[model samples]
Target: MTDRHNAFLSDMAEATRLTQSGRLGEATALIQRRLGVPGRSPDGASPADASAGPHAVPRLEGPAARLGTEAAAATAHEALIPERLRENIDQMMQGLRTLAPSLRGLVGGGLHAPKPGGLEPEGVETEGGQFVERSFSNAAGARDYKLFIPSPRSGPRPLLVMLHGCTQSPDDFAAGTRMNALAEEEGIYVVYPRQSSRANAQRCWNWFEPGDQGREMGEAGIVAGLVRAICTEHPIDRSRIYIAGLSAGGAAAANIARAYPDLFAGLGVHSGLAAGCARDLPSALSAMRVGAPGAAEPGGAAGFGAGSVTQNLRVPTIVFHGEGDGTVHPRNADAVLAQAGIDALTPRRERGSSGRHSYTRTRYADETGRVQVEAWSVQGAGHAWLGGSPEGSYTDPSGPDASRAMLDFFLGHSLPGGRG
Candidate 1:
């Protein structure tokens, strides 16, 4: 272990000692400093200066060390520390039976850790757009998310919840989708919820986990709480709230929409499976390989519950999948439509080309003539964000622009009562 790792561990031990002695305030401050939050240490020195002093340990050499560094450097308010570190902290706190409730909350709660650099994407200017880092916590869990507000807002604007794929950050996803630029043009607000590596090794949303797939539970509940918090703080048109994601994030988006249909007006999924398509890792892999039949159907053996499959309401959904996507099969898009209770009643087909890739879009509408679900099958495209910028990963700049299409579809629909 490097000196820094040792110092971090040692700091934890010292905090435990302080807590046991009933000096909870001091203990909390120490922990905050160790987390790299800007604060004064007990010795009257700044956290940065204290870390470089003789008592500070050098950085370690391992995954644990890397996690510590990342956790300290993370800007997201709810960014989670490594599970092992969290467990240790929890145990230490437990030993301090007399610690104040608020102090304990600070130690155990999701705290903010500002990123070493700014949260804004590099080389991309929104002109009048603003990016803010925020956190939301509830009984389910806590999460850190970024919100983008476009300039020149005359009234309550629409809100778009963008979930990132596995191994992708909010900044990276924003860059790849170029959604910020679109939001600026449309005067919309965009929010991106970041998944922690501690949550999943690849930083994928726990969509496949039973604990996370339900309403008011796990990741779903946390994200919903975040949405509620954002709406409460911003002048969001509740009727126009929408959610979309890519890959694992796409699957998560489906899960969120299914669980909280009233909260979201529509959904956009890219290269993703339907909700409850898998209950575990093995089943998730199976679902991705050939598509899980009846995975989203009511009362199916693989179904999570009755609520897992949409019953009363059909969330307006738009799906995009590349025919050549090897990571997630194209048939999964059909499964998504089926889960939304959309019937294959003669789709309006449209073909388009961007640079080298061509795509075929088929729109499926309900009896009322409202397009409930649409699928885009990009020819010769792989598993990537269609027409995304090259600055980010998992993007094909040649395919149809998914961000623009999704925004157009989202703005067209609202809740049944139209209550914005």
Candidate 2:
């Protein structure tokens, strides 16, 4: 959305809050941003029929214009709600709430999120010239992946394939997360298989659809194929290979694990849900049925089964989410954890003054108690990558650390067997 539009919504929200909260003067001023004293009722004089005399004049032009301009100033206080003056305020509200953020990058110069430093791979020069932006044709490369590799050493290193969320591109995700530096630091190979608009206008991973979330074919298979191809050329530790993503991408990571339990080593899902629980518009609506803010729609029988991603997922996993997230509910973590059946174990629930909530490092195991599923939670954050670039969406860095945990988790495990 344009800054003007964001400002308009901000005015409406302020006016609504002040009016409801009994602050009429402030409310009036806020509402005036759009209404501007109702344009003087079409009369030449006060309370007269000005249009009848062809001399209708605006009532508060001088002072009211000032009010509109002031109310439109930039502030964190902005909320996308149009004032009552607009006949279609409800329609405007959708843009304010749902569409604005998606347009954030388009409107303003995509500024780096809060602290871009510390979040990226520091002290290292770009390993190879620039990660050659290239693609190859697999079975039917309907979708191609943008590849990024670190200093390509002969020895196989771990591979990290990142999936982009809805309305995002591989380059966008890379620009926001700067994962290339991290790949260089760890000597890891990375692949970002971009989704096409044909699959989704927004280019989302399509993890929300039931048909796309399984191993049958389509995106799921392409992703698997991409991983296999990378493993073939790169020195990726088969057991150590992993996947990670933000929202829909996060859901896809989980879905991939379920479709091919033996392939990936772990997942890093931020602000997303497990596979099966939500697929397609109907199921997505169902998963979001609960009336809680960002809460998971308690699962259905068709959701991830006991031995699926939850049980058979022999790899350890880590999750990061903002406690105050309004997009995807934090409670979905419980549902994702539930699918993994983290029933008996409790990690540690670490927290700080800021809202960062982490799970008690619990292990999901089979009858023998071998570690399988693992997770972490961040508090007081909103839909975002913890300690990620402010340039990205749904990210907050000032809380329980997530970037540190992600790297630690990636380093701790490699493919279970030697290049299995």
Query: Which one is best on lDDT?
Result: 1
Q: What overall lDDT goes with each candidate model?
A: 0.72, 0.56
TM-score of each: 0.70, 0.61
Candidate 2 residue runs with Cα over 4 Å from true position: 1-129, 136-141, 289-312, 344-346, 353-372
What's the count of clashing pairs in each model shown? 7, 29
lDDT by residue for model 2 over 118-194, one digit each (tens)? 11121122446234333434443345456676775666678787887665567757766767777777777778887
| Poorly placed runs, candidate 1 (over 4 Å) | 1-127, 295-313, 344-346, 418-420
lDDT score, candidate 1: 0.72
lDDT of 1 at 214: 84
lDDT of 1 by residue, 191-227 (tens): 9998865576556887787788789999999888888
After aligning candidate 2 to the native by TM-score, how far in Å is the CA of 205 from where it should be?
A: 1.2
Question: Can you give the lDDT of residue 87 in candidate 2?
Answer: 38
Q: How accurate locally is residue 211 in candidate 1, as Cα lDDT from 0 to 100? A: 81
In TM-score terms, candidate 2 sits at: 0.61
